[model samples]
Target chain A: MNNSSDPKKYKNSFLNWIEFRLPIVSYIEREYKDYPMPKNCNYFWSFGAMATILLVVLIVTGIFLAMNYTPHTDLAFNSVERIMRDVNYGWLLRYLHSNGAAFFFIVVYIHIMRGMYYGSYKYPRELNWILGVFIFLLMMATAFLGYTLPWGQMSYWGATVITNLFSAIPVIGEGLKTWILGDYTVGNATLNRFFALHYVLPFVIFGVVALHVAAVHVHGSNNPSGIDIKSKNDTVNFFPYMIIKDTLAICVFGFIIAAVVFFGPNLMAEVDNYIPANPMVTPSHIVANWYLAPFYAILRAVPDKLGGVALMFASILILFFLPWLDRVKIRSCNYRPIFKWFMMLFFVNFFVLGYVGMKPAEGIYLLVARMGLIYYFVFLLLITPFIGRIEKTKKLPLSISNILNNNHSEQNKFQKEVN
Target chain B: MRFIFTILFCFTFCFSIFAASETKNAPKHEWSFTGLNGTFDKSAIQRGYKVYREVCAGCHSMNLLYYRDLIDIGFTNDEIKAIASEYTVIDGPNDEGEMFERPAKSFDRFVSPYLNEQEARYSNNGSYPPDLSVITKAKINGPDYIYNLLLGYVDPPEDFELGDGMYYNKWKEGEQIAMAQPLDEGYVDYDDGTENSLEQLAEDVTTFLVWSAEPELEERKSLGIKVLLFFVVAGLFVFIAKNRLWKSVN
Candidate 1:
């Protein structure tokens, strides 16, 4: 069935033979090596590669930890202790897994933020963005389930608080909560089901991630200039150039994670989590891990329980509509002036919400959190849609190559003048 | 609509500020093992073990630790065996199929004070004594909190009211606790000629609890230093390689 116009008519014989049978090797070469990418894509683009590497690190380390972990309530804590003290390199494996989770979230957040800043969610790339949002939601579910496997006080109580939120529903809510727990409380059954789901969800994330990459390849990458590629001069092969840069970024990221794992593994960990789970004794202050803190703040800001749950969920669901929400033709914030300021404000509001979530739900912290919550929704729903139509964007570059090779010095001078 | 929402949000916060008045901030205390290079003081850990045996052991159980684990804290094999034999543990069924009590072996965990949770709560007037195996690592500012709690007890201010079985302490939540003043000056006699005072006992016991909570702390810190060094070197090489690879690009 090989056509006369086929590019691979006289290719490597081994690859041609494989392609004639399965086409798997040809598929990899087409998708990964021959894939044209914007040469102007910055280091921010590297975080996606970093996140994928961390996902693999987490899965490998998680499996080893599961081999040593016991799901029973009575033995779970002791089993973890045994893993720390008795098992060979067990402590190292556990630390790497835990710290790897934290680093994974960090890289994923950067990756998501990069997409937003470059307006990668717009137009033809919308499906890719939607798939990414799904991957993120799955990551959240996996993280929540994995956190409970340790059976620490935070694990137990965090599970209880999150599951009990489902009971805020009128009729099916209570049933759903019980079904989730498999009992009236977060106990041995809850831990078992969570462990089972935690193990399964990562593979599901891996599947969705495959779709995400495929979508990225289908639409091509959005770059800093927000200009489409015109010819071969404006693009680069995905093999040696981008691949080498991605490896360098991953190495540096890995070094930072290793330092944290080895020296102060518990720095980000809550001390209260070291305590064994005691259902009767609730911790005086209950908060989620840092990754979940922003949404946790959103959940707590609303006065009513059901309203809070709805809003907390809506915070994530809102991301799905982002492609339509910001109806601008240009992708990158570098061109959209007013949108750029709001984006920075959005970033600040998120961190502020996180800080407030860590505080007791009272006094000045509560007030600040409430204000931050309002701004978050307003920015996403009202501002993002309308601002694009009114904002006067900068003049577009003809192509990435034009900007890079010709206007490089002139662009720097213009930016300096604008500042 | 957005304006109205912002107004309602602001009004809600005006009321919330009054509700957020009190916060319980745990006080920080200086310890020998606070930083990257910090190591647990061996003698302090041994003294802390003595305090635990004398006072805390009556209520709290360190179920994760075995008698043999004490060897790292300077206890000899014979001493650990002697210590283990002090408690009676239910061993096994004999030829007649009867279970009998026998002295604990060195490998056995510290014998729990009560048989089960129901019994433990009943003896403590409904407030269960938590497991102390990881107590120092489990609580926020656990080392400082434990040390302060030991010395924080005082007569309640005349107007202050306490519930039945509750005692006054400066650092406890609500300024009251179920546990009475546990440590006193010269409570546990130190055979090493160290003076036994409330502060000394508190310090020693805190150190011991930290060790129990993280016995691998010393090894972890040393290994961490080595691993970090290796990463730094390897990272430099990778950086150079990546630079060379990209040299051909515009």
Candidate 2:
């Protein structure tokens, strides 16, 4: 308050004084305030900002939930009931934190799809994409661990099945499984440790997200055309341009989320989760949550236990190597006619695997899951690398500005004629 | 590429509608406490509470509710006080370090039927009845499940051998259940002069259970309406602002 700096130009004097010392304002201004963004980037680009906002929502709601939650085997289930019944707005907080996990994954998945579709993982942006995959891996762990904190039937059995996956390891697997559970089964010790871990993993994710953003800023964002930004005409300031678009996306996204949170809070939830965890009686059907279901499907695609576990872990780990996997010169699928179809097929196959994961590992569903699994591996490991070499490439756009002008010229002949 | 996704979304939606019909012989019953605009019928809830108190309370326990929560189902303060006084709860150790029984208060939890799961199992022939606190939330189409279950008891088919304690329930997964028929005609004499048939009892009890499980349902839906309305208005301005911001770009 007593800073000697002139207050005439500064609306917030303390912030200006702090900025003189730390220079954070200038740093942010350099990195983002006037950051150049591709003018042609579409609604797909909005998801990255949306993911960041949802992460904050999850963290805020999660902290409140953790305050009311009990992490003991004897009291966990009843404590959750108490929270729903007694605590003020505890139901709202619980539902938001629970459903926010799904929403977060939805945004992140779309963000990744955008990355994949435009080959944003290529060239100088490879590290940014790898950092993103790490964040995803951390998110899955956090979500799984948080689910166990409720101590419901689905939470207990899901933890039991997933932990047992480690037992399929060659020799040290059995020891690792016991070490993870702190007992022979998912019990008090497992729940307590999971509570501790879930509380901490989000901070780790936040740190990684910081690095991911830094890496993206190093080379600026990849554009829709997948071409380099050549001059000022090719891009616009991110502040008023991208920020306004993101505000609108957030409103629309928040509206959809409110609809779910308010009206159909339990639509995607497992019914068995409402029951207290009972080791004596197993539920008729056991399944993972929707976000993790595709990998769960890949796990069940194999007959052997060890093989399934290996494939499941391999499926996620393979994304780290995606930068080198698809060696295509053209980035955007819009310009790559043949490769475009394969990419779309892969995207739909992901949803198929998710559905298959929910069904009983029966005849038809099992067959589809296996086929999807095989196609998944074949696309990344086999087709993507070789197709770039054989497929005929389309003519490349000279520049981002040139591409948009061509589109505009076709749409608005009067404006171009007047100009 | 976009076309494929559109088809995938439609296919998944149709599959979801198909999957919702897999309740297996249990028809979806209309309830006063279901759907977007649904609210608990106060009279039905009053009758349902009577059925729960007289019949189901003997086997299962609603351990989550307080005596005071009865106010939501149309009980007055005087009636709640009178109802609570009929039961005794183990309160605390007195000066002598011995726990003593006292008349339950409006704030006290509903008295459970059994002292513990062990007692519940032993008395019920090694099969413990589950808690009814969130039983409606614990099963798919829970009101329908409970209502149909009360009506599901039947004779076994040819060549089917019933276990010593098990009863035949066609709606059950294995067609064998440890729980016998828990409801009968005119089980509880309703004070409201309503019908006391078995089906009426089942429907009323199911309605009360839905309210018990989701006491916040009405508030949630009403708030949802206001929140979504505000969002729609906010969305319009946001869309306009977004369009103006992007007008300079392609």
Candidate 3:
């Protein structure tokens, strides 16, 4: 066939590329043009997009950092310093990577809270919530492993202590611990393994995040009203509006992250980490990173090792069962006064526990920790279930539309009287 | 939602306990070096430089430090320059007038054995002489343990038999140590007129190693305080903004 006579083939190839090779801007526009976002979605909805942006920032900075980092126990710490001192703008890279981690966790926690407030985990969205939890777990694992790669004193000891937790199991606990450590202690073998895992786990997290988004896309976002979008009038398409909103949010979030990196690079890091790993000497206060501090506090609240481990694990696992735990027919917490109060209290208790976790585990601190711990569990297992039931029986609108209509009528009556 | 909360609460509770216990028992670990005042003996650091130059530098590297850092540890600039110049050469371009990598700079990282990976491994019995820049921090026991371990090497215990290809050191907590205590009395001729004792040398080198590990210790602490101040200011601003934003709605 003469090439000059093959205009149809050229046109066909161009169409194929358009169909298969996803163009970034066009794809974003088409996908989000009429995105069925709720009109009443507030600041809370920004958190998921915020988390997604933070993840990308973290991944980009982390990949750059990895290029210069030496993961061996011997050179890891020095390599990090070399990056700070020698590599061009390496300090900036490190700060962004690290602070990005903190920001990521912060956004994720808020995102999860938003889900809770909106009952986003209920009904067909349960799997979406579950996948989100899976993403959270993977994020935690990846962060833990990545933290060990710097090979700081904290990194080594933190890895050692956490790995040793596996020994809490009854029978083959020691073996399991050894297997995890890959040696008698957290040393070269441990660092190497952590390096390998740290590199691999992020991809696993990426996969899970894909699943999480897919689930979200499938079920669609839960609205502030928690009402189903059954008709065209109730729903919007996925394009333009939401895409622009998300883009703006990402830009704002990125600006904040950049500010953190530029001005206060190691603001969130501990001082002791500047020191290399010393196997014989330990840092006086061996604290986990700030992101894990809350859970760490929870772990410390329990007196027993096995119990603490179980509770620590349960803290994360609890999110998976949120859909069943909430008994209210109503999805949003907006109308549930008692439930609203409990949620606020729970948030305060969690923060308090984080504070206690960082303190010296003394007499009063332990007691407070225990109490906080108790309230934390009660909020979920007892308060939520009980409050939801009580609220359901109390004076309530039959539907979200009914509640809106009543509010509208009340507003009209007030306006009429004023006129 | 209730189950989720319950599990979260339980886990948080457990995490708090673990953290608490860790703090409570933190002092017991040999590796725990929390309150280590970076206040090292200057003479020790000087002595460490000697040991490093004589023994450790031959195979183990500490490419992170400069000759200038030795001044803070006690050497004069003249002494540091003289010492560094012996190891490095400075060259510059005629047109650009920019200094290029001719030899080690005063602040250049310690030199490694110029061997390729295979050569370095083969010569060292598959053990690479790890960089000493953060060796003190990398080990759990900190500088004291590193000092001790360097001096601890001895023949295997009488009762314990030795495995082929394994070197045994009874003084070490572990029976096997990759390094033979490289430092020995009169191993190197010291130009500084310091007494040449193996223990003294080991102490010096360990101190120097610690310094290399955290060269910006003083700066980091000061910067940390400044950052804290900035954080407080930022927090205050955010708090005010939040109050203003929510006032009408509330």
- Candidate with maximal DockQ: 2
| Model 1: per-residue Cα lDDT over A1-419, one tens digit each | 65433346436866666676677886888888988888888777888888888899889988988999999998887898899877888888888888789778877877888799889899889999999999999999999898888888898999999999999998899999999999998998999999999998999999999889988888688898877889888888898678877876766666677767877677667777888888877988888877787889989998999999999999999999999998889999999999999997887688678778877778887899899999999999999999977899999888888888766588779999999
lDDT of 2 by residue, A11-93 (tens): 78776776867777768777877999988888788889999989999999989888988999989988888888788888888
User: Can you give the lDDT of residue B156 in candidate 1?
Assistant: 92
RMSD values for the candidates in order, in angstroms, are 6.1, 2.9, 12.3
Clashes of each: 2, 0, 70
Better of 1 and 2 by DockQ: 2
In order, candidate lDDTs are 0.85, 0.87, 0.69
Query: Per-residue lDDT tens digits of candidate 1, residues B1-250?
Result: 4323432453344224323422376566799987877899999999999999999999988888999999989999999999999999997798889999999999999999999989999999998888999887666567888888888998999999999999999888799999989999999999898999999999999999989887888888888778777777876877788688656666
Order by TM-score, highest first: 2, 1, 3
Q: What share of the true interface contacts does candidate 3 keep?
A: 0.05
**Ranked candidates (DockQ, high to low):** 2, 1, 3
In model 3 chain A, the worst 10-residue window by lDDT is A2-11
Q: What lDDT does candidate 3 reach at residue B34?
A: 24
Which should have the higher lDDT, number 1 or number 3? 1
Query: If scored against the real structure, what TM-score would every candidate get?
Result: 0.89, 0.94, 0.64
The Cα error of candidate 1 at residue B14, in Å, is 27
Native contacts retained, all candidates in order: 0.62, 0.70, 0.05
Residue-level error in angstroms, candidate 3, position A365: 1.7
Comparing only chain B with the true structure, the TM-scores of all models are: 0.87, 0.90, 0.63
